[model samples]
Target chain A: MARKSKHSRPDEAFEPYEEHAGVPMPVNWVAIALTIWGTAMLYDTGESVQESLQDRAEDSDVVAQSVPDEGTLLFGANCATCHQPDGRGLRDAVPPLAGSEIVAAGPDIVSRILLRGIDGPLTVVGQDFDGHMPSFDSALNDAEIAELASYVTTRWADTTEATAQTSEEVASLRAEIGDRGSFGGGAELAMMISSLPDQPPMPARSHVQAGDQAARDLVFAGRDQVWSCASCHGDLGQGDESTPRLAGLPGAYIVKQLQNFREGTRENESMQLVVQGLSDPEMTALGAYYTDLRVPSTARPVLSGDLKRGEQLALQGDWSIGVPACFTCHGPSGFGVAPNFPGLSAQHAPYLAAQLANWVGGQRHNDALGLMAQISEALSTQDRRAVADYLASLPPVPAGGASMARMETQDDQ
Target chain B: MNRYLPLSILALAILAFATLMLVIAPGMQINSRPAPEGLTPYSEAEQRGRETYVSLGCLYCHSQQPRSGDQAPDGERGWGRASVAADYTYDQPHQLGTMRTGPDLLNVGARLPSEGWHLTHLYQPRAIFDWSIMPAYPYLFDEKPQAGPGDVVVALPAEYAPQDGVVVATQQALDLTAYLQSLDRTYEVPADGLRDHGYGTPDGPEPTPSEEER
Candidate 1:
């Protein structure tokens, strides 16, 4: 110490045991990391640190358990098929649910229809329909029907008339109706709901039957029943507005329809009157005459519709609703399939739409196994119009001429 | 190079495992299933028609398999119920076609029961429908001055018929019609294997519930 050598300074003795570098404490770094992790958790998850654990636990127990729109789900499942989601009904076939008087009248009528299923000859909004609505009592429970009814009422019924249905009310109505067949047509239904319009009586069943006359008159000649086929149908059997063209139709098909009219199985007010005086032989003669009569299509499309949709229904059928293309059974171009399926090409649009409506209403049920009735039910009013217009636009016969061109082709072959 | 034997053994084991899992197990399961009720064996004529259908590429456009309601509206479309594996017991090589360019033929017989309609349709599809894009099978028919005894004459439209002769269905055409008419799978099957797929296709526009509905 006395020498104070050149190698060592006096300040070295005063220095502490260890040098103090300007580093922060380890605890400070850990605190900063913890703050960042907590911030990230709160920002990304939209969950606070206090409630995140609780939310996860509750989520596991009731995952996707919200039942907010129960009525919507039920309506879509049960009534949406025929009545349509918007409840407009399938025009003159099924009745409209939107702004429907029956729906507006309140839950009593709605509940009864749901439980018992109303059959037609039911008049809704001045339009007559004869559909066969299958009872939903067996298919849906009281609660489900209530939900469906409420949904329909709320969505389509007039706002002033909207009434919510309860399961209790539906249950009581179900008990009151008990087990019964469909409300006997619309008359019986009108009795329960006075607000509903009356369904007009079906054209009285003609007492007239085919007489025992051996009349061999041609189809063009006036008979006792009709003045002449040419009066309503053209001279060449080319039909007018809303009248189906009889020209070039299959003999078997015409005969079958004539027979159907005579038997009163197929309901046609005019045809019934006409067939009453005709014998089986006379019917056969008319079939032959019409089958032989080949005329170009002069019947223009009267009903307005989407031609594209009509073409699709005629050519590619809307499979979405289970309707096969018109060509599938009616033949390639709407020409009649012999003995059963009729030719739709060049047919009157109004007539086609009316027939489709008839099928939907169950007024015309003469189709094989109710095929038309089933298919027509699936088509909307717009779809029916579209198909009708499309068929009316097509040639009744193949392009070029008729048998002459076919014969020429055969000769060439 | 020395590990060649081990490598080959490993590859053989893997191949055997795949075969056992994929082919053998499924084949055994399918073989054990019983045929559904009313599933009768194909008749001689129907079998021949089946052969004709296979040869004619009818499967290219028409499907024999009508899927469940949930998958498609085959039932509502009047194609009958969904097909089951047991439904194919009579089929030598099953015709569960994938394409639906045409309607399903599984229940065509039920929908159209007339033999005459089928014959006419086969002879000339356009004779019944003027706008049908389906190719005509005029070759399947023979034009004769008059139908002979036991000959089935096709009832065609006046324009499509030969001016001097009636069109008679050939044996092949008859067989094909018979086959089409025989495709009736409308009988009920056991509910065990039948699944409910719901109506309409998956791609169909789903109705979204609005806020008011909620």
Candidate 2:
């Protein structure tokens, strides 16, 4: 080894050797740290991307699942409001789906009920559900008909053991009906199918009479002095322009609304003032009376424009502007599907127009109806008149009628 | 001495840069607060009206955002734009709500022509809209005594008078009118009406429609 020069210090002596070294120690540490941080950031970003993709994939899957089983969505959207999400049915007025003999009966009986709505007194699951469940035969396709029937058969009542129905079966039965005529009562359906068990006998007409009288007396009498129900609702409860026709409404729905009016939950200053003095018994009586009255088509207004315009608007909303047609939920005749949507046919045109305007103006509040209001506001005054007139002019499809069977089946699905 | 100068200069520059970043960067944010180009500050009465709206839970059913799609019935109903974040720079707690029991209220004040009509409709919906299902807000107005012949009816207040010089106003009605008039949403930038393009965000250069041999 050569001796170091006297001018070079010990640290300076190493400098010549250090020149050959590749990277400094501190730079190496920094490089490693940066690499680690970059790796972590990339990992997090990848995870988030994966999560987002998974969510989108799941949503698409749900849509795909819904398309094939469209009946499930239809049933949920339409019937779940009244029959409940589980298909167990509602209390008092609606029959149970749990172990009903009716549901377990032959498919023809069920199809008949779907084709024609049950009118007069009826019982379900040992409980009375008197309201009409309208038919749906014309609205849904044959495939939809099969799907709904299958769903109802497999899901509700004690139908786990019963054989499921096919689209061909529903289509065959539809053909026999010949242009979708109405089914009068359970007896008629029973007569058509010998194997089907008879429906419970009709309740005594006297019971209806007594209920009507009690309701009439309560509605007619007022504290001090005021207008009677007849003054606003008209003689047979065929409502005029100022008020809605109350006849043919489901009793349970009427009772709930009347109670709401009296309690101020569903507030209208005029209605509140009108109902303010009535007792609960009186409201009940009023509901019973209204329910007993027969609905008359004569009361419905004759529309001016082409029914086609109304039909187009009702069935297929002006999609160019993203408007949903009214019939999607409110049925073809404007008779609402359930307790959630009130009947529109036979309703006063002025009342309909005002309600539409009010909904647009924010003078009313209903989550679903709010959507309708938004859509309604887009309409010109003339369009509103035309639509309302068309709805008013539509014939009331009779309860338990064949025309409504498809509608009922689709609803159940 | 000269050899050490470069190192010292570099160290000083780095320290100075860090200090400037720490001290000055926060101040930049103050001026950076977004201001939607066309909006103006609300008037004092309008401010009060906004407060009244918040207190009344009006946001529960109504939304401020209008959909971006071409003239949905909702837009035709005069509920203004599907709100952008820029539209709510002034809002402390944004009122772009979700429930829709009633129509959107972003441009309600400008949409409805008459304040008196709103008042009457609010007071007695059934009288005006027979199928109205909304709860009445009678507390908003003082009940006018049932008019009797020869009971010299006082004219409505000067503020309540119609803009066309036709009608008079009540105090409650005036306050409510102040509130409704405050709902002007004219500051919104109109969407370019392009079918697929989203709002606010700039898209590619506009395509000019061709004239057919004009």
Chain A TM per candidate, in order of listing: 0.45, 0.48
What DockQ results do all the predictions give, each relative to the true complex? 0.08, 0.02
Number of the top lDDT candidate? 1
TM-scores for every candidate against the unseen true structure: 0.41, 0.36
Chain B TM-score for the candidates in order? 0.85, 0.58
Q: Which stretches of candidate 1 lie over 4 Å from their true place?
A: A1-413, B1-8, B28-45, B55-57, B60-89, B96-117, B126-142, B148-151, B170-172, B182-214
First chain of candidate 2, TM-score: 0.48
Highest DockQ model number: 1
lDDT (Cα, 0-100) at A46 in candidate 1: 71
lDDT of 2 by residue, A164-183 (tens): 66778878877876544444
Q: Which ten residues in a row have the lowest lDDT in candidate 1 chain A?
A: A205-214
lDDT of 2 by residue, B38-127 (tens): 666676666666676677787898787766423243432445444555566566566778888877776665444234445555555554
